[model samples]
Target chain A: MEAFITYTLFAMLVATALAAVQLNRLFAVVMLSGVFSLLSAVLFVVLDAPDVAFTEAAVGAGISTVLMLGTLALTSRTEKSSSRSSAIPLLVVIVTGIVLVYGTLDMPNFGSANTPANTHIAAQFIEKTPHQIDVPNIVTAILASYRGYDTLGEVVVVFTAGIGVLLLIGRLGRRGERQKQIGRGE
Target chain B: MFVVAAIAVIVAMLLVLVRLYAGPTLYDRVLAVNVFGTHTVLLIGVVGFLTGRPDFLDIALLYALINFVGTIAVLKYFRYRAIGDVSASSVKREKAR
Candidate 1:
C-alpha cells in the first residue's frame, strides 16, 4: 500500500512536469510547474521528510509560480521558436545528460544499506546529530550545524543573483531613458 | 518500483529540458527552467529515499527556497525593463509626430 502511494506520487510528479513542458502558453506552463512542485512535496511526505515537504509546498508551489507568472506578464507569452535553430542547446543538453548518466553508472544500488554514503560523514552525523544538536530531525541538525556554511554560501549566491538582476535591469532602464531623450531632442 | 518511478521523473525532466531548449520566448524558457528546478527538488528528495539517506532532504529544502528567490529576482527584472521600454517607445512616438 505504501509502495502504491509512493509510486502514485512519483507518477504525478512526472505527469505535471511533462505538462509544464508540453503546454505552449507561458501561463499554463507556470501553473503546471506549480503542480509539479506540489507533487514533489507529497513525495517528500511519503519519504518521511516533513520539513522538506513543507518548504517545497511553500516555495515551489507558492512563491516560485507567482514570480514566474510575474515574469511572464512582463515578457512575451509564447516562445518564437520558428526563427532560430535548436541545435546548440540540444547538443549541450545531450552532453550533460550523458555525463550524468555515466556518473550514475558507478553509484551503489538504490537503497543499498551498505553504500559508501552511509558509511561516511553522513552516517556519523545522522547517528550523532540528535545527541549533539538536541534536534529530533537529524536532517535539520546537519543542515543547521554541521553543514551550515554551505547553506550560508547558498544564501550568498542568491544575494549575488539578485544584485546581478538589479544591475542588468537598471542599466537597461537608463539606456532606454537616454534613447527617449535623444529622440525628443532630434 | 521506485526505480520505475525514478525513470518517469527523469523522462519528465528531459521533456522540461526540451522545452527549455526549444522555448520561443525568454519567458517560455524561464517557465521551463522553473519547472526543471521543481523537478530537481523532487528528484533530490526521491533519490535520497531511494538511496536510503533521508538526511539529504535538507539540501532539497534549501534548494526549493533558493529557486523561489531566484525566480522572483528574474521576474522583477523583466517587469522593470518592460516598463522602461514602454515609456521609451511612447516618447519616441511623440518625437516622430
Candidate 2:
C-alpha cells in the first residue's frame, strides 16, 4: 500500500510538472508549480521524511508561489513567443535526464537498512540523541544540536536572501515619491 | 484503514491537480490550488497515522497555516495588484498631491 501511494504520487508529480512546462500563461504555470510542490511534499511524507516535506510545503508551495505571482504582477502575464529553436534545449534536457537516471541506478533501494546512509552516523545519531541531547524527536535533536552549525548556515542563507529581496523590491513607498519628483522636474 | 484514507486523499488531490492544470480562469486555478493544499494537510495527517508517527500532525498544522496565508496573498494580489495594505496606493496619491 505504501508503495502504491508512492508510485501514484510520483506519477501525478510528473504529470503536473509537464503541464506546468507546457503552459504559456504565467499565472497557470505558477499555480501548477504550487500543485507540483504540494504533490512532492506528500511524496516526501510517504518516503518517511516529514521534516523535508515540511520545508518543501512551506517554501515551495507557500513562499515561492507568492514570489512568482509578485514577479508576474510586475512583468508580463503571458509568456512571450520566442523565435529561438527549442530543439537544442530539448536534446540537452533529455541527455541530462538520462544521465541523472543512470546515476541513480547505483543507489541502494529505498528504505534499505544496510545502505550506507542508514549504516553510517544515522545509527549513531539515533542511538545517542536521547542521552546526549535529551530531545524526544531525534530529527530535531540532530538538526538543532548535532548539526547546529549546518542549521545556523541555513538560517544565515535564508536571512541573506530575504535581505537581498528587500533591497530589490522593498522600495514601493519611495517609488511613488521618486516618480512624482521626476514629474515635477520635467 | 489509514491506508485507505490516504489513498482516497491522493485520488482527490489528483482530481484537484487536473482542475489546477486545466482551469479556464485564473480564479479557477486559485481555487484548485487552495483545495489541493487542503488535501495535502489531510494526506499528511492520514499518512502520519499510517506510519505510526502522529507527530507529523505538527507539520500538517504548519502547512495549513502557510497554505491559508499563501492563498490569501494570491487573492489579494489579484484584487489589488499588491499584497500589502490596499490603502497604500491611495495614501501615496494623497502624498503626491
Candidate 3:
C-alpha cells in the first residue's frame, strides 16, 4: 500500500513538472511550480519525513510562490517565444532523467531494516537519542540536538534569504519613499 | 486506508495542475495554486495519521499559516507591485522612519 501511494504521487509529480515546462504563461508556470512544491511536501510526508515536508511547504509552496509572483511583477507575464529549438534541452533532460533512474537502481529498498542508512548511522541516533536527550520524539531530538549544527545552518540560510529579498525589494510599505527614489528597479 | 485518501488528493492536484497549465488568465492560475495549497495541507494531515505520527499536525498547521500569508502577498504584489502598499495617510507616517 505504501509503495502504491508513493508510485501514484511520483507519477503525478512528474506529470505536473512536464506540464509546467510545456506551459507558456509565466503566471501559470509560477502557479504550477507551487503545485509541484506542495505535491513534493505531500510525498515527503508519505515517505515519513515530516520535518522536510514542513520546510518544503513553507519555502516551496508559500515563500517561493510569492517570490515568483514578485518576479512576474517586474517582468513580462507572457513568456517570450524562443526562436531556438527546444530539442536539445529536451534531449538533455531525458538523458539526465535516465541517468538518475539508473543510479537509483542500486540504492537500498525503501524502509528495509538492513539498508546501510538504517544500519550505520540511523540506528545509533535512534538508540542514543532516547538516553542522551530523553526526548519522546526522536526526530526532534536529532534535529535540535544531535544534528544541531546542520539545523542551525539551515536557519541561517533562511535568514539570509529574507535579508536578500528585503534588500532587493526594500520595504513594500514604504511606497511613497520608494516612489520618491525613482522606482526604476522593477 | 490512508492510501485511498492520498490517491484522491493526488488526483485532485493533477486536475488543478491542468488548470494551472492551461490558464487563460492570471486569476485562474492563482486560484489553482490556492486550491493546491489547501490540498497539500490536507495531504499532510492524512499522511501523518497513516504514518502513526500524529505530532506532525504541527507541520500542517504551520503550512496553513504560511500559505495564507504567501497567497495574500502574491495577490497584493500582483495588484499594487508591492506587498504592503502604503496609502495616502500612511505616506505621512513614513517620514518618522
| Best-matching candidate per DockQ | 2
When summed lDDT is taken over every stretch of 10 residues in candidate 2 chain B, the lowest stretch is B82-91
DockQ of candidate 1 against the true complex: 0.07
Off by over 4 Å in 2: A126-160, A171-177, A180-186, B1-4, B90-97
* Candidate 3 chain A: 10-residue stretch with minimal lDDT: A168-177
Error of 1 at A55 (Å): 2.1
Give the alpha carbon lDDT tens digit for every residue of A22-137 in model 3.
88877777777887888888788878787788888887887788777766765678888889998999899899999999999999888889988777888888778878999999
lDDT per residue for candidate 1 within A1-186, as digits (tens), equals 457557756775666676666667765576567657766776776666767777777777766766566556446787655667879998998999999999999999866878877778777887787788999888777778878999899899989987986786557656756887898796
lDDT of 1 by residue, B9-62 (tens): 767876775666466676876677577667767776677777776677776776
**Candidate 1: which docking quality band?**
incorrect
The DockQ values of the predictions, listed in order, are 0.07, 0.71, 0.58
The whole-model lDDT of each prediction reads: 0.69, 0.85, 0.78
Estimated TM-score for each candidate: 0.54, 0.83, 0.76
> Which candidate comes out best when scored by lDDT?
2
Best by TM-score: 2
Write candidate 3's Cα lDDT for B1-97 as tens digits. 8878877987887788777777777888888887878887887777777767778778788877877887788777665564444355444544554
